[model samples]
Target: MGRKAIYTRVYNQLRYEILSGEIAIGSPLPPERKLAEQLGVSRNTIVRAYSELEAEGFIVSRMGSGRYVEALHPAPSHAQTHWGKQASGKLAAAPSHMAELLSVTDTYPNTINFAHGDGGKHTLESSCFSDYVKSTAEQLHSYYFTSVQGLPELRERLVAWMDMEPISSPEQVVITSGSQEGLYLITSLLARPGDLVVTEMPTYFGSLQLFQSLGVQIIPVPMDANGMRIDVLEGILARYRPRFLYTVPTYHNPTGWTMSLDRRKKLLALSERYQLPIVEDDAYRHLHLDAEPPPSLKSMDRTGNVIYLNTFSKLLFPGLRVGWVAANRSFARLLTRMKELSITTNTLGQLALAAYLRDDALRPHLQEVRKQYAEQAAIMAGHLDRFRPLGIRYERPAGGFYFWVSLPEEINPRQLMTECLQQGVSFTCGDMFLLREAEQPYIRLCFTHERTDQIDRGMKIIDHVLQSRKELLS
Candidate 1:
């Protein structure tokens, strides 16, 4: 073979090994001279390959310790494909903290798991839901499968409920098992491997997992109290040209920060400027305890650039697993074909939910749920106010079910979680939210699941744990 062909072969093999996790992150690669000798190539060829890898941020060279693999890149926040399991190569293992959170199984033994984002089961109490289920069961015998894009009635009702502009037609909506599935389908249809995607730093863990799985390169844009820092986003778009922008604009998860009207306008403008699509996840928008929910990003989208996704899980029941997407008619047709090949989301569930939404009972039940969540949020805030330790800070969420608390820098949240679990109070460690291997001294506590007394008691236990570990903080 020619010298160039020989060099190319050696380079491709090494690249494959690095990406497949054969070399592993932070591990020293074989010496360049040794690698060349093994591959029957010149040392110059190996050197050229290593240099290329370093420039691409796949690996780094240390002055004396030799070359080691760099950390894996962050995935997009909106799409499930970006967040799916990594497929070999020099990819770092899923962050240890996220793995620990997912593996936590002692739900009833000792730990009071406030870590999960789900509202307490009490929110499921409603006679209307039972009524709807019965109505759906009666129709099941006569039910033929609905159109691939889902029941036209449900799509029409969803758009009206959100107060979104007229969708052109029912063909523009695709029902899926949940909003997560909708996100996965959208990304699969829109993005290719190596596409750049933008998302908020410390965004939803599931979204991060999906994007990582798809091998999409993620650019983390920092979010502030108002929402995503539009200034930073503009700079990123001009420089990186991401394929899409993913956001949870109203009552954002984890942080519970909503974007302002002005910022929302700027976001849409930025998308138009860059010709990038926006994937808006509005899962928690309907769970507002406050009087007026902010107008959604979808409501504001005018140029057909935004794809909106929402679920009935938080507002009604998660077990139903019913969610839908509002997109351009052409894209929706493509996604429906994808959904048909996958499982047609439970017909019974969709029919039941359609009945529930169509009835007058849903509004009154929602009022009751809103009252309950408001009370729970108040109870949590009151407890935190009375017993919170020095140096701890938290945002008072206006609508959603979570309280995002930031702790002292000296404390390790992972260790604190262990200590709290020992005390029979459980919450998520903040490190799980991060894309990189950095430590964050924060925890997400879900107030909607527990009674007021339970919230008070849990706070007391957490306070004691922190007091006992105060020495560790220093």
Candidate 2:
């Protein structure tokens, strides 16, 4: 065959081997001359084929050393059907109630969605993320699959970025598709059917979804302004012997409460007493408005009981879908294997994130986000305070982008949500975050996505609805 045909043949062969995991991650490919001799093709054909593979993110080259099979390939066991029956039985059921609530889109015509946690600033020029993307494109030729635990260099840099001492080794960290995936992996590995999983009442809706999917019995404990009620948690732990207690101790999702330092200590004490693992979800930990963020539970754990899950979706951009888990080495290994069975995350995205983390641009960008979110949150809170009727109550959040508003007993938030949607304002009903069917006339309003004018307009419409209802009552 001609050189062109030969090149195509060699390229496809390498591609299949890489995808099938016959060539392991980080393994070196034969030199161009050696490969040419083995295939009985010219060195130029081998070089061309290798070049094509490299360009498509299938391989990486070291300056002096030969090209290596990029770690971008899927793990060897993904194609195996051995786990299919188990997975089918486990995941066949529909998602939990909270999951269904999260899936509901707020894209009604003319409606303003204050429901999402994302920033509303969509202009490419306004986002510092554009810089990360530009930098990633520049290094596209060299990008490759990161280690299962993620790139060591990126983890090391993350250590510095998070203001913590470096981990002893990279093997203790497992890079996940997102914090959601990290939670799922941890729950699947540590929890069994009928095992009790503890969490704050009205905790992150996504965590409830994960635990439900794994068939774990949820034990919801109540929380006050200081965060999860440690006294109540102690009593529950003594009774239930839960496998793990999941929490967002800082800037909690729906309540927007931060745990006090004393409560944090008490939580660690409870962990020690019960020997229950703490799955600390720090998804919003970085979006602090007032001061430097609190030390992560993983960082504070001396007995190795805390499994920390963090993500880039809040601090950086949501679309990246990159996060990591810091846990004991044993658990990390199981998570890595589990990830192999699941669909591998986007290799290109991981590489770009690694580059972004390494570029030292995150700190200033985060500072800008914190400032903007703080301003926007304050604006929304002011409008709510001024417009909301006497029966409504809300606590100003210390950090993060959400405000949980508790409405009057007379007003049904579910019905109000529907009416508000008609008025072009959208927010999540509070029942969406609860585990049981307990009713609370509340809703979560996110101030991050809308402009000041939009927030003002939305609140005015909601007030109009409330006033109109009051007039009918009179």
TM-score of each: 0.79, 0.77
Q: Write the per-residue lDDT of candidate 1 for residues 381-445, one digit (tens) a residue.
A: 88677545556888898787788888875677888888888778888866465554344567888
TM-score of 2: 0.77
Ten contiguous residues with the weakest lDDT in model 1: 85-94
User: How much is 377 displaced in model 2, in angstroms?
Assistant: 1.0
What are the lDDT figures for the candidates, one per model? 0.74, 0.74
lDDT of 2 at 295: 72
lDDT of 2 by residue, 1-474 (tens): 577777877876776555433454456899989989999999999889888888876789899987876533111122327758667555524235544444445246557777777766642236566766666667754355556666666667666665544246666788788898898888888889767777777777777666665667666666788888887677656656778889999899888898888888889988988898998888888788898656777777888888888998777666678888878888888888998876566666666666667776676777777787888888888877875554788988988879989887667788888898877788887867764333466789988877777888888888888777766666
C-alpha lDDT of residue 291 in model 2: 84
Q: Lowest lDDT 10-mer window, candidate 2? A: 71-80
